[model samples]
Target: MQNMLLFFLFILFMDGVSGADETESVMEGDSVTLHTNLTEIQNDDTILWMFGPEDSVVSQITRKAGLTSFFVTDKERFRGRLRVDQKTGSLTIRNTRFRHSGKYKLTVSREQTTIKIFNVTVFGVVGEMDEVKSVSVMEGDPVTLQTDAEIHSDDLIVWRFGDKGILLAKIDVETKEISLNDDDERFRDRLQLNQTGSLIIKKTKTENAGFYELQIRGRESSQRFLLFVTGE
Candidate 1:
């Protein structure tokens, strides 16, 4: 009887450990869903979602006497990006960013306290542009940063240059606004943003030979290109 008791205790311990923690990996600008495996929530049950090392409360839902009250954290990183399902107690995060990578805890309170922990890792994605394709152009020629993807109305495109990552230009598809950061006059009127979020540089110079980066909002990754401008 003592041996059987020990065996049962060991099984319970293992089950508790397995049920307490989980790990997930997702790319930046992607969405992730954490499920609670609950088909229905009773009025007496309470659910809470917390994040990070501090375990700051991100969301909470309490049901009592058939009345439900839902609350969400006011943190800017999670604002307008979190969704909770009342029935299943599942949490979904939209457009996940690097700041969102951390530990998440879900607690359900009722007759028995249940806890679920998730260790989430968010990876930055490299965009679809060809990294190895060295764009060669002669001085005073025009060079286009090619982007093959279709642009959405709500999309935003940003261009940066060099190891210092200096912002060159930004284009907002929805607002149809193009902002040029021509602090050094490197790309003045010579720069143009096409409808497809590509950058066109007219009158390319030898000083333009460097690395350029292109990032699009709602995209899972950014693209980098090496520009080579040779003298005619």
Candidate 2:
């Protein structure tokens, strides 16, 4: 009975020594935040973060006085692409991708024994080009195209037209694809991505039209685009 009582006290002590949020959110193009709430440490406690789905060391931040930054052991593809909120201990990843989603573990340690657990989640935007549902383009004049992908961005995006099977742009987080075939040739360089994978075609004409396909690429996934051209 005496030994059992001592063991129970030890369990209680272990439990109270370290406590961290086991429910971390992981998303593509976004950093997942894991938090620790450790207490009762005589000296200092170390907080270590680990990731899987690729089985790599994500980062480690030692919780001593207040809070510190975690050294990303496997944040190669995620360099300059992730951020952690110091105040809230929240992690945010920029340009979230399908390959960037998975589970992570946080370990807290003092002297004798340490505690660790995992925070799992799936994160990333699909840039739904498949939901294009419909498309419309005009001749001689630039045709405006749209897609089902809601998070659209211009400038830093790729817009592949037709079945040419070529990457239109190098870096497109979320945006619609614009066809190279312009309505008036002059408007060829004046198009851009809209909120819904829609491309803004300028100077519409009768000779500048046809059915085009749209495809969206991400760090881990790709979406297809379908377009249609109409005569006015």
lDDT of 2 by residue, 1-232 (tens): 9999999988877753433425444444454544444433233555555554233556555556754545654446566765644443334555655434334445555664454444343433455423333333444456565544445454344455432444333334433333343443434566655545556666654222222345544423334433333333
RMSD of 1: 17.4
Off by over 4 Å in 1: 1-18, 127-232
For candidate 1, the TM-score is 0.48
Q: List the residue pairs that clash in candidate 1.
A: none
Clashes of 1: 0
Cα TM-score per model: 0.48, 0.35
Q: Which candidate gets the maximum TM-score versus the true structure?
A: 1
Q: How high a TM-score does candidate 2 get?
A: 0.35
CA RMSD (A), model 2: 18.7
Misplaced by over 4 Å in model 2 are: 1-31, 37-43, 53-55, 63-70, 85-90, 111-232
lDDT of 1 by residue, 166-192 (tens): 999899999898988767566766787
Assess candidate 1 and give its lDDT.
0.77
Candidate 1 local Cα displacement, residue 57, angstroms: 0.2
